[model samples]
Target: MRALIAAAIGLAAALAVVLTVTAIGAPPGETSPKPLRTTVPEHP
Candidate 1:
């Protein structure tokens, strides 16, 4: 019974660490902007 409880606690801790790391490693919004399109002229 004690072992089971310990294992659950360890699993929860691992999940929390993974989530925190992933959140921190993600890039912030608006870091990369989209390019604008330009019209091209036709040649005769």
Candidate 2:
């Protein structure tokens, strides 16, 4: 029972870390290669 409780706490902490990283965007050594296009080009 105690082991199960500890496992659950560990899982929650891992999830929290993942969520925080995702909220902060890309990590230090990586970045987006291209900027997003917000508008469509006019037809020829």
Candidate 3:
């Protein structure tokens, strides 16, 4: 019973993270100025 509750909490946290990141980060597309995954390192 405790294990099941823990699993549910973990799943909720994972989903929250995914949702937050998705909301904050722009999707990779032609309209976006930068790509999601860039090979070049930041100089600054």
RMSD of each: 10.0, 7.3, 7.4
In model 3, state the lDDT of residue 9: 100
**Predicted structure 1: lDDT:** 0.88
lDDT of 3 by residue, 1-44 (tens): 99999999999999999999998998676676766875777898
Rank candidates, TM-score, best first.
Answer: 2, 3, 1
lDDT of 1 by residue, 1-44 (tens): 99999999999999999999998897766654876658776879
Clashing pairs in 1: none
Cα TM-score of candidate 3: 0.57
For lDDT, the strongest prediction is 2
Worst 10 residues of 3 by lDDT: 29-38
Candidate 2 lDDT over 1-44, as tens digits, reads 99999999999999999999899988568567998889998899
My TM-score estimates for the predictions, one after another, are 0.55, 0.59, 0.57
User: Which scores greater on TM-score, model 1 or model 3?
Assistant: 3
Q: What overall lDDT, based on C-alpha atoms, would model 3 receive against the true structure?
A: 0.90
